[model samples]
Target: MDPEALNPVIDKAVESGIPVVMFDADAPNSKAYAFLGTNNYYAGVTAADKMAELLNEAGGEVGVVTHPNQLNHKERTEGFRETIEKEYPKMTVVDVKDGRGDQMISKEVSEELMREYPNIKGIFASEANGGVGVGKAVIDQQKKGGDIHIISFDTDKGTLDMINDGIISATMAQGTWKMGYWSLQFLFHLQHDIAGELEGETNLPRYVDTGITVVTKDNVNEYYPGE
Candidate 1:
């Protein structure tokens, strides 16, 4: 199951001995056997480094927003925060809002942040929905889109448009297809001994590093919808 978005639901299933495999995000505490997803922390770290490279001199205030209390969001934010603080102390993270994966709510939160932090020069979003939501908010304000330098996650429809239109800066594309594919594969292997599992390999790889790539205006066509 795609536990990245909903940990508790998957955790519950895992506790009940249901063959659950995670994706995109993880559930370490849950008894789930295996996880098939990206190293979200590293993804966050890479995003921060890219932002620093893109806006080294234009640093003012950066913000990160995500769905309220999501596991993947939490990990992404943690990585982003840790990397930014450790490497680019000049850039500061000002406000963090919970968009709840809702467009209206994300819009409202982004608008409020803009009003509150006029110096917000850049933004990093932890998920596809939050990225598009913040992008829409910035566009509605008629602000200089390129100047904000947004870095987002996933490849949703709105996010793709924002990247293409230069409303957002870049996005980290995750192996979502792998998330689905491996989750099922691992579950099947666990159920059947066709492969004859090795001894001493009791637990699954505590963490699986799926993979990620940065999508930007320069190479946006490489990730056009349906491509």
Candidate 2:
């Protein structure tokens, strides 16, 4: 269903007495019981920070590629653009391409981007597949990876490999496993009649900060997934 089309279904679920929590992205208008995922907007800002740290000096066009038309990607791009414009005014965002979440399409799109914007100084990917796709493009083109900073999302195996080999400069980490675990845990509690809201002013993390981390070549080894 289209994002606009999801609100009704979400409302129906909520009406039927189901506690809903959206992962990866939130449905602001829907009656979602809670949001358990990364602070995507901040994640984009984090990406910009990583890019600035990697480049050390700003004043180049930043290109973003992701699954086009996705609400999450759209928010990320907006956040990244807003931060870059406010903080690194010299760094112009030249273009954004749609990867369609397909590796082959991502490669093709990345190749096209390379040709269109040869001076692209930085690249930001908002999803795992897109990041790996862009990584493959950089490797295939034989560009000096370090010369052009690349920031990606997630810690998938392919992304980790790229970080290790120095193809991707950094990646934004997300707690995929924790999201599933907590979502179910919350649902279980709701079903068990446990109070959903906080008891008092003692404070409650209204949203679970599943957390995020920046993975780079310098610290990539530290983030190797558990065997």
Candidate 3:
């Protein structure tokens, strides 16, 4: 969706005394009350660190699969790339390709990437579908749980399963429940003028870092539902 298109709607909602908060994806230019979601850039940095560790600091070529134009994905990709370049000098980003947030497309693109850059040692998947797709590509190529490591985003069931099977090395898990709960709290505060109770502060924080965790085989069982 066009960020510009959202500006008018967000402005109208604010003008009508309705509170708006964006999560997962953001429109920084919008007049929403706040953004409550993962610190996508930092999550990307986390992925970089995990990927480096999985490669045992002996860095090699890595590829990225992500939504190319979305704001959150863009930030994540940027963070991963920048961190790799600055801190892991031995690692290089061989290519970045759009996954379109679809499993099949991601798999196809990942397969192409693997074929093109056979020396690629790792891949950072910026979303769940992309992560699973990358895993499938690796498996199809008979490289699953082998030299190519994968660091992915989110803890969807498929991603977790892949991690369990050693097809994916790790994943960045977001605080999804916190995003929902805090978004409501912020909206309630705005609607009820709760901030007026504060001595000096009258505005909610513009951005909230919902936080992220690296999920790996050692703790993968903990992330399962009800575990």
Candidate 4:
């Protein structure tokens, strides 16, 4: 949806004295009270560090698969590229392709990327669908268990399965539960004017870092329900 379409909705809500807290994806131009979700940039940094470890610091070209136009994905891609340049001189981000947050499209793009850069040693997928798609491409090309490493974001069932199957090396697990909990809490406080009770404070933090964790083979099972 066009982001501009949300401007009036947000304005209407705020005009009606309703508090809006964005999570996962943000509309910065809107009058939302706050954005509560993972620090996407740091999540990318974490993916870079994990990729470096998986690559044993030897370094090789890496590609990024993500939603290029989305704010959160852009930040993640930027963070990953910046960290690679700053901390891992040998690692280079060779390409960035828009996955459109779809499995089939990401798979197609990953196939093209692999063909274009056979020397590509790693890939960072900034979202779950892209992660699963990249893993599928790797598996189809018989690159699984090979030198190519994949680091992705989120712990969706498919991504977790890929990690367990040794297709994806690791993934950054966002604090989705916390995002929901805190978003509601913030809205409640705003509805009740809870912050007004405090001395001179009338608003919640404009942004919150929900958090992230690197999910790898060693602890992948722990992330599942009733595990």
TM-score of 2: 0.87
C-alpha lDDT of residue 212 in model 1: 88
Residue-by-residue lDDT tens digits, candidate 3, 166-224: 89999999999999999889888888888564454447888899999999999999999
Per-residue lDDT of model 2, residues 1-227, tens digit only: 14566888998998898767777677778776777888778888888877877767558877888865887788778878888889987788888899887777887888788888888778898888988988888886775542566799888889999998888989998877889998888777776657445553112244776878888887777667663
Candidate 4 RMSD to the correct structure: 2.0
Looking at model 3, the pairs that clash are: none
- Which 10 consecutive positions of candidate 1 have the poorest summed lDDT? 193-202
Tens-place lDDT digits, model 1, residues 83-172: 888888788888788888776777788888878887777788888888888888888776543346788888877888899898888999
C-alpha lDDT (0 to 100) for residue 65 of candidate 4:
99
How far is 108's C-alpha from truth in model 2 (Å)?
A: 1.6
List candidate 3 stretches off by more than 4 Å. Answer: 143-146, 197-201
- Give the C-alpha miss distance for residue 207 in model 1, angstroms: 2.7
Query: Each prediction's Cα lDDT score?
Result: 0.77, 0.79, 0.89, 0.89
Off by over 4 Å in 2: 143-146, 196-206
Rank order by TM-score, top first? 3, 4, 2, 1
Ranking by lDDT: 3, 4, 2, 1
Candidate 2 C-alpha RMSD relative to the actual structure: 3.2
Per-prediction tally of clashes: 0, 0, 0, 0
Error of 3 at 40 (Å): 0.8
